[model samples]
Target: MPVKTENAEQLSRADREARGKDAQAVAPLESNAEFTPGPSRDPVGLLLEQEKTRVPELLPVRHGRMLVSPFTFYRGAALPMAADLATTPTSGLRVQLCGDAHLSNFGAFASPARRLVFDVNDFDETLPGPFEWDVKRLAASLAVAGRENGFTAKARRKIILAGAESYRTAMRAFAEQPFLAVWYAHLDVEDAIAQFRSQMKKKRVKATEKMVAKAHTEDSTKALRKLTTQANGQRRIISDPPLIEPVEQLFPDVRVDAIYKLLREVLGKYQRTLQSDRKHLLEQFTLVQVARKVVGVGSVGTRCWIALMDAGDGTEPLFLQPKEAQASALAAYCGRSPYASHGERVVAGQLLMQAESDIFLGWTHVTGPDGVDRDYYVRQLKDWKFSFPIEQMIPSGMAAYAQMCGWSLARAHARSGDRITLASYLGGSDQFAQAIADFAETYADQNDRDYAAFQAAAKDGRVQTTTDI
Candidate 1:
C-alpha cells in the first residue's frame, strides 16, 4: 500500500461521516468525529518509521536482518500489517480492535468486581479497525501455536475453524441480547472453573484444578522472585546479557538517582490522569520499591518499569507498570489520529473496550536525557491477572480458551461499535467466517516463513540475537 495523499483526504472524510453516522445511530455511543485517520502510508514505510523512533540503546545491531525473516518480520511488522489491512476489503463496520490480537495477547486479569477474569490485555497496537482483522489475527495465531505444539495439520485446521465459528456464533448471540445485559456479561474465574469442570470430567478436571489452585496461590513474593534478582545487597532486575539487560546497562549515560527522580515525577502525573474518586483511592497507596523489568518478545527493548506500592501494609503490595508508548501502528496508514496524545488514545480505547478498568489508568509525557519525548501510561501491573499457558494447552483446552477469547472480543466490539448496523452487515451467513479462516491459514504460513527467516538471519550473523542465558 502506497501513502496516497488522496487516500488521506478520503479517510478524513470517511471518519467524519462514520462519526456522524455513529452519533445518529445511537446516543450512548461516543462520537469520534474529530478522530482523523493517519496518512495512507504503506506497511513497510510505517515499520521503518517505528524502527527509527525506537530507543537507540534498545536497537539490535542486526535490525535489518531481523526484518528479513517472516517471524521476526511479524514482530517488527505490526505497524505495516495494520496499514495493509486498513486498505483491504471490509464490511465498513468498525470496532475497538486489539490492534495486535494474536493468541498470546489474550490473558487473565481481575475485574472491577474483584473476580478473576481472562480477556485481551495488551493494547499497544489497538485502534478502530474492521472487526474481522482482530478475529483473523487471533485465529491465525491459534493455527501457528497449534502447529508449534505438535498438532497435526488436520488438528490445526480444526482449531482455526472452531475459533472462527465460535466468534461468529458468539457475536450473533451477543447482538440479540439486550444492551445492558451484553455490557455486563463477563466470565469470572469461578464461572470459568465451573465450565471447565463440567467439560473435562472428573479426571481431567482434577488435573486442571491443580493448575488453578497453583495459580490462585501465586502472590507478589513469587512474582517478584520470578521477575527480579538480588544484585549486591539490593534487589534488581536480572540481567541476562543482551537479551535481558538491566536498566543501568541499557542507559549507561543516565545516573540511577536521575532515573529515580524522573520516575517519581512521572508517577505523580500518572496519578492525576485518574478520575477524582480513583485518585482519592490511590492516595492510600505508598511507593514501596521500583525495578526495571523486560517483558514480551515484541516489547523487549522498550522502557518498561515496574513499581511496587504498598496499599495498606507490607502484605498488600500493588504492582504498577509504567510502559513506554509509541504512535499507533495504524496511525500512519489510516492517516495521524485526531488525538494529540497517544497515551490518551490508549486510555480512551481501553475504557471503551473493557467492562471495567484499573482506577489508576493514566498517561504522561517525559523527555529523556537524550532529548526525545517519551510517552507513557501507568496502571496496576498485576492485580490477579492470569492466563492458561498456550504451550500447555491440549486440543480441547485450546478450543475452549479460543472460544472464550472470541466471546470476549465480540463483547468488546459490540460495546464500542454500532451493534445493530454491524449485525445487519454480518447478516445470517458463515461467508465472512470462512473467508477469515482461509486468510488466517495463509497468514500463519507467512508468519512461519518470517520466523524462520529471522532465525536464519541470526545464524548467518546478519541479525544479532542473544539466545544463551
Candidate 2:
C-alpha cells in the first residue's frame, strides 16, 4: 500500500477543537489510576526460561569467562516482567506500542524516498498495550542508560523528567493540532538539526553533528562489510564461535538445513504478502547469501537470519531480517489479538505505526523438527538505519535526545490509536507527566535492584550468560 501523507493545511479547525476537548476530558483519569504491579514471580527463573526457549547460545561460556552482566540479564528478563505488567490496571487507552521501548531502540533510517530520517527502529517486542507501559519503559531505560554513561544522578533524573515532559507536552500539542497536522508530522535530519541548533549551545550542536556523522558512516556498504567477511573470496558472515553461530550449530538434526529451506519458502510467501507492484520490483533482486547473525542485547539468542539479495547489479544488495516471532507479552493483558498469524500481527502493526516501511515486510510460519510452528516476521535488516550512542551523550544532549524520542513515540501512538480518547485521557495539564515521572523514578529504582539481583544470580551460578559478541 502507498504511504499515507497528510499536509499541515489538511487539518480542519473542527479537528483541532475535537482534539482539545478530548484532551480536556482524559486529563482527570491520569490522577485517578494507580500503577498495578506485575505478578510476584521468581524473576531469575523467568529469565532462564525465556533464554532457554529463544536464545540458548547466550547461556554458554567461553574462555572460562562467562558473558553474564547485569545489563544482559535484564535484557533477557523482559518476558516475565511483561507477563507481570499485563495484570496491572491501565487507563483502558491502547495503542500499537513498542513492547520494548528502551532508549536504545530509537534510531535513524533512510526513507523510501532516500531521505534520511529518525524514528523508532526496533519493534521486536511490539504489541497493543497501555501507552503508559511504553512511556515508563522508555523513561526507565533513559535513566539506566544515562547512569551507564557516567552522568550524575541529578543529570539522569533530569533526562528522565525531560523525556516524560516531552511526551506530555507533545501529546498536548498534538491534541491541540488538527488531525491531519498530527498525521503529517515527522522529523527530518535537517529539521531535527535545526531544532537542536535553536535549543542547544554551539558546542552541543557540534557534538550532535559529530554523532550524526558517525551514524552516517554505517550505511549499506559498511553494514555489508561488518556482517560479511572474505571466505575464500566469497563474502559470507564470519563464523566466530559463540558470537556468530553458523548453521552448523542448528544442524545434525538437519534443523539448520530445514530452517534455510524454510527461509526460502517464507521469502516467497513474503513476496506474495506485498502489493503486486512491490513484488514485481522485488522480483528484480536475486538471493546471494544467508547467515544467522546474533543481534542486540535482548535479541542475542533469538533466531535472526539475514539474507543478502542482489538487486540489478551484484554490488547492489538488500538485507532482509527474518526474526523469530514469539508470542507478545501484551497478549495476556490486552486480550487475544484479531490477527490469526503472529507474522500478520507484526506486519500490520508496523504498517500502522511506521510512516513508511520496507516493501518486503511480511510473515510466515516455519515448522521446526519438533513439529512446532514458529512464526517469523521479515523486513529490511538495516537500510540506512542509525541510532545515537547513548553512552556518548552528555547530560543536556541526553535530555534533548530523550525529548525527541518521546515526541516521535507519541506521534506513532497517535497514528494507531483513538486520538480523541487518548487526548481526553492525557488532558492539557502535566498531571500525567508528573504521574509518569513518579512512576519512572520508582521503576528506575526497581530496574537497578533487578539489575543487581541479576548480577548476584550470575555470580552465584544460578544463571548462565555468554558475553562475547
Best candidate per lDDT, number? 2
TM-score each candidate: 0.81, 0.85
Candidate 1 runs further than 4 Å off: 1-49, 56-77, 196-198, 201-203, 219-221, 225-257, 311-316
Model 2 lDDT tens row, 1-469? 1112233135665664465455445534454224445546566666666565665555544201323433344455566557655654466566788777777788887777876677777676677777777887787677667766788877877888788778777776776676688877876875788877777889878876786676666555676777777667666666666656556464556765566676577688778888898889878887766767766766766677778777854467677888887766566666656777777877877777776677678887777556777788888887667777766788888888898898888888877665555665666666666666666656666666676766677678776644444
Per-residue lDDT of 364-418 in model 1, one digit per residue for the tens?
8888767788888787776666667787777877877787787778888877775
In terms of lDDT, model 2 sits at 0.69
Q: Which stretches of candidate 2 lie over 4 Å from their true place?
A: 1-39, 60-74, 87-89, 201-203, 230-233, 248-262
| Model 1: residue 117 alpha-carbon error in angstroms | 0.8
In angstroms, give how far residue 356 of model 1 lies from its true place.
2.7
